[model samples]
Target: MKIELIYPRWKKLEGQTTFHLPPHGPVVMAAALPPGVELDFLDENVDPRDALAACEGCDLVCISMMLTSQVKRGWALADQLRARGLRVLFGGIASMLHAEETLAHADALFLGEVEGRLGAVLEDLAHGRLQKVYNFMQAHPPIELVGPARRSILRDELYHHKGVRMVDLFHASRGCRFKCYPCAVAYLGGRSFRPRPMARVAEELAAIPNGRLFVVDNSLAQDKEWEKELFRTMIPFKKTWCSHTIEDDDEVLALAAQAGAWYVYQAVFDTSDFIRQRVKRYHDHGIAVEGTVLLGLDDQTEDSIRRLIDFLLEIDLDLAEFTVLTPFPHTKCRDDLRKQKRILSDDWDRYTAGEVVFQPKHMSPARLQELYHLAWETFYRDEPQSMKMMKLLQRAVARERALGTYRGRRRDLVRQSFGRELTDEERGV
Candidate 1:
């Protein structure tokens, strides 16, 4: 059987950074497929050829739709694939929550983890007895069996920035302990935390073949004992990594730093004293902290919004990412806004965190949107204060790249002086 595992383009608003990381969901699905299937994996964001041409002669077209920004594109691609008499299946977080809408485009919809469900789907395909919907959210496959993501199919060069391939997305766990109103993790992965076995996780990390990684777990600090053990086990691998954090204990923070922790996305919900202390603790442990601030919350006003940005600088956070409260489908925030009839737009394009699509309790939607843009503009403006913080890192990165190039050239020149033919590695090509 020939299958085209596709990742549709996610729309990004102007001024927003288009993150072109390895789409872990689709590649992981490709990894989970049963044997005897030929997979042509195309992340359309980077591999842009006509979608129809890309999937030509493929028996099944499977698209993983996780972001609202890309749901529309996934649907269009699904429609086209179905028009060509190809079987189209839609799955992932976005499709899981909006299954009814997704069914309109796909011949089948796969809800929940692909671990146990994919085999049955493939069997159905082989026998020509595929069902319209496959439900496997209830079946929790043990973490060890989740399988490694198939990365050989990736075009790695297309995902680099400033000579760094950024980070490889790897999941050591599923779900989160906290059910934040605006987040969809709980909805998709459930409230209870499920972690991959420590040995299994270490093996996956070793297989990645990259020093920089982004562990896509909800919060690595949640289970203290397991995290300590995981960190201790990771010492031999010596890979630098980062993950998101909740308020963590001193011991866990210490363990994380020892285990190659580089930075963490610590949410700054407010300018509270504890938030300041938390940032300091991370810095004290030699782990940089990135502030993930959610703007336009019910408590935020224009004054408060500006004050938050000022507070970020005052705390000397390594970096910051600002986002408006996006009401994704099936999340608590979306449900509440729907009850109040405050959702202003059904358009998925506006769902990017930069745009305001729902009514807020304290301010006009327009005001909230304005403040969102202002938060970014003010943080990244050409002022010495802002530039000093951000540009310092840019300059440091530039220096590292130049130094690496110099060392490579120096080595090549020495080899040439020996009158030896250049090996592929020595050519510095």
Candidate 2:
């Protein structure tokens, strides 16, 4: 059976530049399909028309999309594919959260992780007995079952403009242990960390085309022992990699750097004076810590936003990603925001973490939007002569050079300033 898997793109907005790549979920799923089922994967975020065309010869189509923005486009594509007489299967965090709604359009909805249920779904399809829903909760299908995903699947031409020759993505673990108010990880993978064996993970990392690695684990240092094992195994490669980590362990940070982790994405939830000291420590370790701050938490105020921004500037971190507090489906923040009536918009497309979905307790939505832009402008606006920026520029240049293509792409709604603060359109209450 020919199966086509798709990842959709959101509508474009002015001044926003989106980094489009095939998300890890569908690619991992494709890796898991039982033998004899021909597979084609499409990341519509790169080229929508080509992705849609790739679906032409497939008997079955599977789609995975983000919950907030991509659902509308995902549903539209599924409906179109269904109309053309192809069996449509849907899954992803979005589908898992809104399974019944997604089922209205899809012939089957594969909820949760796709590894365990994928084979059964395929088997059922072969016998013309496909089920309406397949859930693979807490099941870790063997890594070897899905043939190693070739790095060639991502176009070499995409990274050319930045001068980076190659990039490869690896998944070392799944789920998050912390119950961050705005996170969707706990909802999808539960509040526990399930790491693949260190040897298995290292082997997969070794298999990728380029030596450059991006470990897609939510938090890499949740388990110190596993992390130590991983670092030990990776030390031999001496290849530079990037991953997210919490701010607790100095040993783990040092080991990660020794293991070729050039970039560390660290979250500074509440920027206390103590946390500021930790941030400085991370920078002192020769690791380019991209310090991130959440702006719309319950107690966020303008003074707090400015203080956080000032702290980030003071720390002289390499890069930063500033995001509003989003209440995604199945997250504690979502429930809390619902209860507090803080959600400003229910449009899933606006929930990209870039937009203000919930009203702040201490500030208006407009002020929040202003602060969001201010954070980006403050960090990226000033061109610095520091080695960190130089290194980031080098990496960015290398990445662009490796991809070999450049186009003037505009930013999306989330990246733009709101002319007027928008309110929930669905509410007449």
Candidate 3:
């Protein structure tokens, strides 16, 4: 049987530098499919065409969504495909979060991880017995069942930034132990942290052809011993990577740096000394820091938001991404906002963290929106976002060179060169 897996695209945060990192959910799901199925994958962010063209004589089409903003587009695509007499299924994070609504637009809706589960779904499809919903939200498969992502289905050439090949997304673990106020990870992946076997992780890392990767684990700070062992297993690969926060310990940091840690997406929520020291420790370990700062939190006033931006600069973050607090479905932030009647809109499209859809505790919605832009502008005033990103790329390249894993730049493709000013057309003029 043949299946088409399509990842629907969503609008990126306007305040950040625009680029597409390959999606991980679809590829990982692809690996879980039973053997001998011909798979056609399309990441609509880079491959703009809808799945109709790829679904020729296909048995099933899976619409995988990872963000709230993608739900509308995913529903539209599913509606369009089903109209043409093709069977369409909805899965992934966004689909789980919005399952009740997504089922209206899908032939089947799958929730929870796909490992060791797709065979049954496909068997039902083959026998014309497809169910309306396969709810596995709480029935997570054993972590050992997770396998290497099926990247063979990806069109690798389409994923790049300027002339540099973007990092391939990989995950050594699943689930997050911490449930932040604005995050739905606990609701989606459970509060227990489930890590893949180290052997499996090593095998996946070795099989990945890319020299750089973005380890897309929800957070690596959960199990200290596991984090250390994962880094130790990765040391020989010499592949530079960026990931979410690692365990904030001297030994863990040392292991990570030895494992070719390039940079990390460290959250900077406040101007406290503890946060300052956390950023410093990452930098001290020779890992570049990219501060992921969320603005317009309940405690944040205009002055506090501005202070946070200044603190980011003071800490010498290699790059900073500023986003407004978005209350996505199933997150505590959304529950609180809705209860207080502070949520201004139910429009999921505008829920892109760049836009303010709810009233702030200390300021008006308009004021919070203005501060969002101000945070981005103030952070990148001296150094353009692109320039800061290019430096991170350079550091990755240097690490590769030192480890004898560097491949000379590929000059055949045409895109804006890093460190060069973006053209008017490239800048959306």
Candidate 4:
């Protein structure tokens, strides 16, 4: 049997550059496929022109319905592949959001983690007993059984630009313990944090050839012991990686830096001085900090949004990603908005973090959206073009050098990664 797995590009606004990181989902799921299957993987965001090519000569074509930004394209791609007489499968976050519509497109829908389910699906396919929908949410697949992602199957060239690969993605843990309103993780991966055993995590890290990684855990702050041990275990690997962490403790932060933490995705939800202090601490420890601003929060006004941007500049954040407070399906935020009649649209495309889809508590939704756009514009606008490009180049060079991963094609990939060629983020980051 043959299988083709795909992770599609996320559609974003014009002028913004995207660098496709190594996708964690499709690679991880590919690891679950039983042996002797001819496996192929495609990252549509990089070379979208030939995304459909991966389906050729495959027994089963699987495309991830991963995010709101990708669903529209994901559906169309799945339908097109199905027309080619291939059996199509849909899975991931978006599948949970648009299950009914998704089911109509694919031959089967594999819901939630495939740990305990893929074997059955492959077994059934062999015996001709496959089902239309396989929901493994109830199984709560044991974290111990989570296998190392089959990273070797990826087309490395597709991930590199100008010479450096942006980042390799992996998760030391699954699910989020907190039920934040705008989050879809709790419903999808359950509210509890399920971490892979430290030994398994170590083994996986050793196997991944890339030194630069993007740890996809929602937050490492939830478990101090696990976070500390994770970094400790990673020290031997000598890998420099980044991930989201609200870990405020000085000791924990120090340990992470010692383990080669390049940076962390720190959420700046308010204008509190604590935010300033925390960012400074991260800098003090030789770790860069990228701020994630959630713009459509009830407390934010036009002035507040601008003020946050100013604060980000003042703190000299490494980078900032500004997004509207999206109320996604099965999230507490969506339920609350539905009750208050604040949801403006259920149209999945608009659910991209850049667009506002819900009514705000203070300002008009349009105003919130304006601020969101302004934040991105103001962010890059305030920085000189040369400085922006220089910073981008420096970051790329440092990561590539640190990992010593890519060779020969470095200069061109680095230049392209910086948008020297005017490529809109075809896919990634």
> Whose TM-score is greatest here?
3
- Give candidate 4 misplaced runs (Cα > 4 Å): 384-429
lDDT of 1 by residue, 249-350 (tens): 788778787776777899998889999999999988877887898987778888888899889888988777888898898788998888889888989877
Tens digits of per-residue lDDT for model 2, 1-429? 898878777764333433444366676777667778877666665543566677887989988876567887888898988887888899877888767678898999887776656788888988999998786655645544434554544544443222333346677777778777767777678777777776677677667655556777888868898887788788776566777873357887777767767677888766687767776776666666787778888777789888888878877777777778888787888898899887778887776777777778898888898899888777766753243446764654454354442222222222221112224441222
Question: Which candidate number has the best lDDT?
Answer: 3
Alpha carbon deviation, residue 88, candidate 2 (Å): 0.8
The 10-residue segment of model 3 with minimum total lDDT is 413-422
Best-first order by lDDT: 3, 4, 1, 2
**In order, what lDDT does every prediction score?**
0.77, 0.70, 0.88, 0.79
Query: Where does candidate 1 clash, by residue pair?
Result: none
Clashes of 4: 10
Candidate achieving higher TM-score, 1 or 2:
1
lDDT computed for candidate 3? 0.88
Q: Among all windows of ten consecutive residues in candidate 1, which has the lowest summed lDDT?
A: 405-414
Number of backbone clashes in candidate 3? 0
